[model samples]
Target: MANGLDFFSIGGADAHDGARAVHAWHVIRWLLCGWSLLVIPAFYGELTSTSQGALTIARSLYLCMFAGFALCLLWMLHTSRKPKAWLAHNRLDVTIMIGAAFSAGWGAPPWQTVEWVLRLLFVGLVAIRIVLSLKVFFAPNRLIGLLIAGAGVLAMAGAGFLWLEPRVHNYADGLWLAFESSATVGYGDIAPTTPASRVFAVFVVLLGYGMLSLVFASIAAAFIGKEERALRHEMHRDIKHLNAEIVQLRAELHALRESLTPSSDAITDAEALHSVPRDHH
Candidate 1:
């Protein structure tokens, strides 16, 4: 009688399906881009009435930023899913969002609908980026560092609010509020008074601290790790050099001893000549 062995196979065909999820996001992003293009003409009303050319530029930048970032985010998700991938996206995303938020706020007039839209977009992008990127900093020490950075952003934002008395008039004010919310502190003394402002505030509150924390922590950790690695490499190089020097010194010492000592043949010949003198006697 012969026995038979059974083999089993498991798992779905899309082994790295999460990676593919980013591509779907890319398709969604293009659709949004088409919509943004269509919407540009509509912004004429806000641009013409407010006379905020800077605001127009800022708004256009953010729209493009979002689309560009959405594609990059998809690619990032495809290749990696760690601090490296997440931070890479967050770095550009946060910088753009923060800059746009301030530029639009300061450059554009409030009565313009475009200004409000720009603000909302900036807030949304930053909040979303932060929320999504938080997973990269999981360690306790990193978490603490991130928390501090969040707090700093929030503090700056709060100070701006207090300075403006809750009025977000310009980039300075936008920056202040963005940082404050990211810090996780809302005094409510100078809170967002308008509906749009309030909504954006909520969005910032939700994503601010968490996202900033991870970004700060991941950046710090990377720098510290790089520094440590460099130091270790230098130390290793120095140690190797020292070892070679020690070997050379050892060889030199052996040569020195050979120079100091007479050859056995010379000693023996001397003894033979001296003994031959005695034999001659």
Candidate 2:
């Protein structure tokens, strides 16, 4: 995925540059989505079974995702006028992709360890991309989209528990444990026993906490926004009413001045006429 900071420059000085940036962004976003879809199933398959067929499929999917990442980088490079700058901004992506490629290619036992580490890194990168994409593209109902994403992540974590946690015999129990762990409720039931499951539980707990906090913040913001809008509407209405009253008062004052002017002039003329007649007599 393109750097989130670069997204703001989609409208550049040149129209063609802007168009290329937008196209690159869309291509990267879609490719990231596809990689996410492929990786989830592959990860689950590898987690659940050690069969050669399952391993083959998972490997194939991983290769495809890696290829997609390379294609995204290439697309951005080709479309960008500032190739050096693009590379500079995306050093993390380039490093992850190179690491993934090296890990997949090397055959040593130590390389196997590197492969797993790289996988974790790639997963983290994808998670960040998913969150950023949801925020940028789903602006109209961002909160709802984020909630759905959080639920999906938790559900997948629950599925992981089903395979990792021996105590989680059934899918429902796995979900229960996942939720309880994530919410920090514990409930003294369905705890993870295996080291792998415990580690997975830690990940679930942290991810869930962050996502849940975001959900609550979004809800509060929505309520606060509604209150602000209502207050603004009331203020506008009161201002309009005050303006109308001021206009009416100004009109009445003008009419009162007009009405008094002629009467005052007639009284002055009568006084002058009486004073002149007395002088003539």
Identify the candidate with maximal TM-score: 2
lDDT of 2 by residue, 1-281 (tens): 75566632322123355577666676576665666566556554554545767666666666776787788778887888876776776555565456445433433322266656765666566555555545563343369887787788778888989988888888889888889988989898788886557757877887788777878877888988999999999999999999999999999999999887778779899989888844454
Clashing pairs in 2: none
| Model 2 spans with C-alpha error above 4 angstroms | 1-16, 36-57, 106-119, 137-150, 245-281
Please give the lDDT score at residue 96 for candidate 2.
Answer: 47
TM-score of 1: 0.33
Q: Model 1, which residues run further than 4 Å from truth?
A: 1-49, 70-126, 138-143, 159-188, 208-281
Please state the error at residue 18 of candidate 1 in Å: 14
Error of 2 at 28 (Å): 2.7
Task: For model 1, state the Cα shift of residue 191 in Å.
Answer: 3.3
- lDDT score of model 1? 0.53
The 0-to-1 C-alpha lDDT of every candidate, in the order given, reads: 0.53, 0.69
